[model samples]
Target: MNAPTVPVLQVHQLTKSVQLEDEVLHILESVELTINPSESVAIVGPSGSGKSTLLSLLAGLDQPSSGSIELMGKPFHDLSEDGRAAARAGTVGFVFQNFQLLPALTALENVMLPLELQGARDAEAKARHFMDEVGLGHRLNHQPGRLSGGEQQRVAIARAFATQPALLFADEPTGNLDSANSQKVEDLLFKLNAEFGTTLVLVTHDRELAKRCQRTLVLDNGTLVEAAHASTGA
Candidate 1:
């Protein structure tokens, strides 16, 4: 018999609550889902609909009030803070709308940070390879202030992929780009995923971007629902 596969990410009864003096805000509620390895998924919703909150929880960056999560077959919600950090270090990558590059670091240094942190001896070589992959080899020594928004985001994408994580969490990866740059970044994102078999979980308001994913999860006022199929459902 063939070996069974494990989900790249899994969640059950996930929820987040916050106190606001006399009232409680439920940021997420009873959310449950699973993502297979190498799958690309999008989480879409209006502002304050808990899309980002869900992403944070799924990535184990934020704690949920009640529920469970498993990332890469390891317990997420149940892990201690230090343990969760270790888990993330091993199997997660992230890209943000703001690009989140360190102003003091050059594109090459920015791409090398993660590998260096992991004590890889070949960080520079690996970073250079990814930077070249993202078409930034010519700009490797440029600092964030010297690069355009698109270039900065490309640097960010290069950094995110240097670790080759099992899953990539992208929060509005193209939110800050112009239409042309956005399309370029989008094309690169898909190409990287298909090439690396990295499971992608993106939180985006862009319908076109979401449509490119293999699956879409819609969040509405803290509830989770899978988007309807185009041809199989009305």
Candidate 2:
């Protein structure tokens, strides 16, 4: 008998809501999902559909109000805040729609941030290499404000990859870029995935981007429904 494959991420009956003065706002309800190692999946939905919220839960950045979440085969709810942060540092990388680069840091410095957090030696060298891979070698010294939007995003991508995380979460990664720049960033993302065999969970409204993944999951009012299986040829 063969051993069973471990899921990289798992959520069971995940629910999140907030109590308001008037009524309760249910952001997510009874959401169940899983991602296996080396799989790429896209979560597609309109604004206010809880796509970002779901991503947060899966990444262990935010806790689900009710339900269990296991990341990298460990029960997430059982971990302390510091434990969760350490787990994320070891297992997850996140790219946000807003390109959350520090205004004070240069592209090189931004890429080095993750490695520094982990106390990795030779952080500067590794940061530069990743930045070069993202075609930002020339902009290494430029701060976020000095670089263009796409350039800033590439820096973010480089930073996300610097730690060589097992799973990568990207929320509307190309949402803020122009068409050409979007293509560049998209290509870089997929290239990294192919090279590293990284598990990907992406949230986006772009149909074209969603189709590129092996699976597409749709969220309607915080409930997940399978949209389509993996298909070749975009």
lDDT of 2: 0.88
Tell me each candidate's TM-score.
0.96, 0.94
Best by lDDT: 1
User: 165-217, model 2: which lDDT tens digit per residue?
Assistant: 89999999999999999988888888898888788889999989888888999
Candidate 2 stretches with Cα past 4 Å from truth are: 1-3
Backbone collision count in every prediction? 0, 0
lDDT of all predictions:
0.91, 0.88
RMSD value for candidate 1 = 2.6
Candidate 1 residue pairs that clash: none
| lDDT value, residue 198 of candidate 1 | 92
lDDT of 2 at 213: 89
